[model samples]
Target: MSTNPQKVHFIAVGGAVMHNLALALAKKGYQVTGSDDEIYDPAKSRLENAGILPQNIGWDESKITDDLDAVILGMHARKDNPELLKAQEKGIKIYSFPEYVYEQSKEKQRIVIAGSHGKTSITSIILHVLKYYNRNFDYLVGAQIEGFDLMVKLTDDAPTIIIEGDEYLSSALEMKSKFLFYHPHIALFSGIAWDHFNVFPKFEDYVKAFEELAEGMPKAGAIVFDETDNMVDVICEKERADVAKLPYGAHPYEVKDGVSYLITEKGKVPLKIFGEHNMKNLHGAKKVLERLAITEDMFYEAIQTFSGAAKRLEKLGSNAHTQIYRDFAHAPSKVEATTKAGKELQPDRELIACYELHTYSSLNKDFLPHYADKLNAADKAAVFYSPHTLEIKKMPAISAEEIKKAFGREDIEVFTQKEELENYLKAQNWYESNLLLMSSGTFGGSDLNKLTEMVLALPTNKKEKAKPAAKKGSVLGKLFKKKS
Candidate 1:
């Protein structure tokens, strides 16, 4: 540690990403201190363990000292926050989360993964593969990947940094999208879909965020985009001569006996993850890795061991005939893709897909129509939203009939009460059926872990155990299988 370490203060440190960044900076030998009005578990405990938890909650103007190196602000901190006022009075440098992130990594080669969906998965894949090779790299991903301790990392030694660029507001003081601050040397635009209705009220305003990102690429920067998404394709088509445009689609793969495999030049490479969306994410990761000099063989070998990023088709528990999965999918595009992925994974099973309207866009009456038929792939579909959430968001009330009409499925179940939703799910026949729960927030504070256990223990109608399918190849055939 340096004798005079950088002194950084967090105005509001209890946020998911804010707390994680605090931990990361503390670990990097910075003198980190923070305060929040209310600190919850995980963040509270982690900060306590690090010996940096504030002795008291709420902002303190005295904590904002003249000698402070920087003040990092979280979105939770209002513009009129006491500490914020002090920092401004002292003329101390203040940075929004994304601005601070860019400041720390500006000297390194930045690879930012940006999209409406699959940003976390793509970023996780790149981090996992890079870690597998024992390469020196830093990353900032949203979800908790399996091998990583924190969701954010910053260091002085790493030559490159990978960032999961979100299209959300940076902070209260800065309303610009977080991705705008990244200014990546290499970037991937996975796809575009209208979301965050509270932030970008107009659909064109949402698209314009990506348009600005594409328009601002530095000379010699590269962007790997998904051509399958017409919106993404059209945006990338407006050419910038200095920026190289790379396009990728879903990779070739086949599923047999409840397992998905990638057809590669080295042979049939089995994967722990499935679904076409994941395959597309895998191919996108491969394209990004190619630019980093990771060959196809290396990428395939490293990817085989990666299960998935947390909450992206994450399996909770599974029985022979029943499997329970939970995903963080709230937007229309994500809902459709995740639902289709679940159905495609187990085409033979009855898919009972349940979605919770949690985001501002999902709860908006106008935005409800975009979700039309998104749940159509499910054998039985259900939608749940807490009326209380609408009250907190100050949105107008919507009825069950309105929801049903918007979905274009009269038979689809809609529940405003958590107990009613749980009861409805508990009443289902679990025999050979798969349960998929999709939400960005908890289903009105449902204990999903306990629910998963209950669903897994539910009775199935199969009288005898099913036999495992025989493999088409022998051990020698597996060894000599050719890569595509």
Candidate 2:
């Protein structure tokens, strides 16, 4: 409750995750203070509204003293940060965000969703079910879900906590994965592929995180995993004897009249979402929920109205003639799943997939080969990235051809200019087609919703024959037919 007011200082608290945590602590009546080198939009407004934004933008060693109970460090903070050095010198207790999360979640039964791509979706699904049933739970999710305003929640009343476990490290001081601190009683692995090249550096090193998860679990803990993922299968199969390992693959489903329905013994469960990848995600969620004692019937009921996490498969804009969808897919495995998932919905429709090499792992030349043939499912594929971004990140410059070769696609289209790509897209024919945009970051700050609207407004024509006809019905009519 608001009774205890332990003072907590945050160093580099402007990060997406850190800001949410700071807000959570303050709402619980703890005195919270934070600083960042530069506070940008949204985060700046949020911190100010919380009334905990530091007066100065940079860290001050004078701010750290023995009076503070704890200091939470963000990933953006450097090892030699003035405040961090001062905290160490004064013998103050310092913790990375993950370590602090572990301390908070220790009393609750933890349910962690881990994977390269679908962890956010899986965690959202479980949280949605819990919300629908009015169950009390503390949670830490990656994205802002429909019912939850903030991403992190800490409360003594909630006996359970759901976590979207990321493989990234805690901070510069701790070289361990964030999920390692979770020590989940119920853990799910949707899949694993190489990521975070700047840290792990090798594919095997990247794969070791999951292995550690399996090894650390208690014998009675429930471990759910995707049997279809080779790396996940290998890791979970070798688990400790006392740990109960449960495997779930894709739930058998059918696409009927452009809609996906899960075939269940009780009845067919209708879903608003499409794609086999989502079906796999649904299966994984069901297993995890069942471990938490949620009935199968209830799980299906809660997900009926679930649109999805914001921007995982966001509808930017659309007209009757064409549709545009954007996804937060940047890793190689994610690219493969998202591209193929779009195509699965409309087999005959031309699928144009665009991606930006935004993440540190994706931009590294040494790690490029991991993405080989990832975009093969798309009829038209393009890679867009900013040279200025590489310079800002201090990474080596990469050319369009290098991306093409790395992906092993000779016909790959690459662009350095956002306007040029936008102009080119505006000039293309969007009729009887689908557009899929994949990236972890915005493509040079171009508003995808605006682009989607532009593509959707393209003149639509109808004809009894293959030739164009007078303006009639919209593009969805044609794309839906192709899927059938």
TM-score of 2: 0.93
TM, every model: 0.94, 0.93
RMSD of each: 8.5, 6.5
lDDT string, candidate 2, 166-211, tens digits: 9999898998899998999989999998789898987788788888
Candidate 2: worst 10 consecutive residues by lDDT?
Answer: 465-474
Best by lDDT: 1
Tell me how candidate 1 scores on lDDT.
0.90
Indicate which candidate wins on TM-score.
1
TM-score, candidate number 1: 0.94
lDDT of each: 0.90, 0.84
The local lDDT score (0 to 100) that residue 68 gets in candidate 1 is 97
Alpha carbon lDDT of residue 447, candidate 2? Answer: 80
> Which ranges in model 1 have alpha carbons more than 4 Å from their true place?
462-484
